[model samples]
Target: MKIKQLGERALIQRIAGLLSGGSDIVVGAGDDDCAVLDTGGDDHLLVTTDMLHRKTDFPEQMTARQIGWMSVAVNLSDLASKGASPIGIVMAMGIPPDTEVEFIEEVVKGMDECASRYGTHIIGGDTDAHDELTIVGTALGKVKKGHLIRRSGARVGDLVCVTGHPGTAGAALFALDKKIPVSQDILKALFEPVPRIYEGMALAGTGSVTSMMDISDGLALSLHDMSMAGSVGFRIYESRLPVLPDVKRLLKKQELHEAAVFTGGDFELLFTVAPDKIEKARKACPLTVIGEAVEKGVFIERAGRVEELKARGYEHFRQQGQ
Candidate 1:
């Protein structure tokens, strides 16, 4: 099969499968990112690495600073989902030797802005020469005892909620690709995503929230992960999903159902809270109740018919490339 047909995610899975691993791993080689042991006293460390290839992650017209900012933000966002505070960052950078020094400087500038904004420091990093540009970010975070929310703690009867709106980023991507006109506001929102640090901090000590994850790949797939990780089913009400107008304008062939249900890049938080604490959660922070956890299998209510929720989001090792 062609390389594109196999997709980058698939290629990674295939490569990952070919290797054998050792025992230093607390959590290894899967999920939104990876976590390794710190061996420090009384604290569980979270280590996540994200690599952004220039062509894959950003357009040619995008700014280097924004690219750096997003790279750090994406990793920090993962830490927030698990209720961790970022501590330090290390980077492995590769770029064509001919690349402008100013571009490289801007990237570092953006990374510094994001790091300082979140109070995380870039302690160490490396640079290498390559034919194409790539940035690999490794972030370390710490979570207090009993505060780290896993993908496996969701229980039946827990209410499922998400922070902020969905589908805007995906919509923006489609609009740009199709040469469709989108408002400047949406374009900016799409190019630059805000990680939900406030909502994440609020979830601390929230006894109601059982399981949590960031909606990185897509809400549908993220929800699917919670179901599998927690061993519970999910019942999502599509009617309750929040969507931006920019997304609605781009839904030409697919109905609103498809756009809101499967599109990714929203970067919001997907979490499960207990029924009793729903009101308390609302008072404490902003969220939308899109569904509840069930006993088995995923179900979605749409068009007045309740049917099984299919796998509609991107999968790393799926049949073929996107």
Candidate 2:
């Protein structure tokens, strides 16, 4: 059977099952946004890594600078979801020998700019020669004891919330794929995403956030993740979903809904909070209450009816075969 038959998440679970860790590991694989390590101090260490490839990840419209910025931004998003502060990042680049030196310089400059914006820096990294341009970035951060948020802590009746807007990156990609003209703002949203670092920290500080995860794989897939991790279900409201004006105007309602559910690269955070703590979350961060956690099955209410939410998003291995 082909690898796609197993899918990306399944393959990751298979690999995670083979790995073992000691007591120093606070959280293991397939559990949270980032791996937690006990530092033998008041603060715990958080680590996450992300990779970007030219042919598969980067779009033709994005420049070298945007690509480099994105390489760091994605990893930082993981740290943000965990309520960790910026420590530093190390990057490794695989480049084609034919690439110009100026191109590399611009990419590095972009990486530096993004890291500085988020109060972090790229201390060091390694480079290797390859046929395609590939960037791998590892981000390190710290969170206080008893303050780390996990995806497994969500409880029944917790309000499902999301920061800023969802489906912008997905809408941008949809325009690109269709050869349609898009605004610069939309392109920027897709090419250079801003990780919600401050918002995440603020929400975590409120002590009301239960389960949280970054929405890199689309809203539907993210909800599924939280559901699986917490062993609970979600009931998302269609009326509460924050759809952008451009998306609503450009695509039909059905197309827009599909894009919001299945489009990836948005980098927003999906979190849960108890009903009593909803006011705390609202004051601490800018978020919209999209739904609530249920007792059993995941469903979405639209037009006064509810239905099962199918998991359909950007799966690397699954897309290869399609």
Candidate 3:
């Protein structure tokens, strides 16, 4: 079957099935945010990579610096979800021949600033000529073995939580599409997302967090991912979601709810915490309890009616409106 018909997630599962994993590989492909490797030390090594293209990933409104920052931010977000402290980043860029040198310089500067903000640096990278501006970044990180969090440890009664406000990025995208005037703060949510590295580490240290992942692909899709990983279901309440005030004003109630649920690119942390340890988790990081884990089925309760939360987000390679 064609890849589009198979879908991105299924294709990943197929690819993962063909690969072989070793003993030192704590976490392998298609399972979690980063691949964990036991380095025979107190900490495990975390590795993740992400690819972004100009047309698909970078919006036209983004500056050269934002593009560079996003390239590294996406990779770091993955490491953050695993409670890993970033060591360094290696970036590979595919640039068009006609691109200006100054623009490339700004891109590099942005990458450097972002990495440095998170206490890391761009150690090495490669560049090549391509038809479009393409960037691929690989981030390396380490986390104490006892403090490491993954997407599979969620238990059936754990509380579902998320950090920061949801739907801000989606709202920003909506505003940009509609040509509505929006503040730079809202626009920055999409242009320069802040990876929750500090919060992730704090949560990991609390030992209250059960499962964790970054919400780059919208809350619905991320929750579905956690559900699959932990073999549990989630029933989140719409009223409990912490949405930005700007988003509420930008869209009507229905639109706001939909944006919060389905829109992607937030890059916030979505995690589950043990019920008894909820206070500890809260003390470690600012989070809102949106729901609780259930035995089976992912559903959302809105207006007193519960509906299935569809697994849909910013999927690549699949045709739109499929």
Better of 2 and 3 by lDDT: 3
- CA lDDT of each prediction against the hidden true structure: 0.77, 0.88, 0.93
Models ranked on lDDT:
3, 2, 1
lDDT score, candidate 2, position 245: 88
Model 2 lDDT per residue over 160-235, tens place: 9998778788788888999998778777888999998888888888999999989988888889988999999999
Per-residue lDDT of model 3, residues 1-322, tens digit only: 8888888888999999999999999999998999999999899999999999999988899999999999999999999898889999999999999999999999999999999999999999999999999999999999999998999889999999999999999899888889989889999999999999999999999999999999898899899999999999999999999998878989888778767988888989999998999999989989999999999889999999999989877777787324
Runs off by more than 4 Å, candidate 2: 320-322
Local distance difference test, candidate 2: 0.88
Off by over 4 Å in 3: 320-322
lDDT of 1 by residue, 135-154 (tens): 99999987765677778788
Tell me which residue pairs clash in candidate 3: none
User: Best candidate, lDDT-wise?
Assistant: 3
TM-score per model over all chains: 0.88, 0.97, 0.98
Candidate 2 weakest lDDT stretch, 10 residues: 313-322
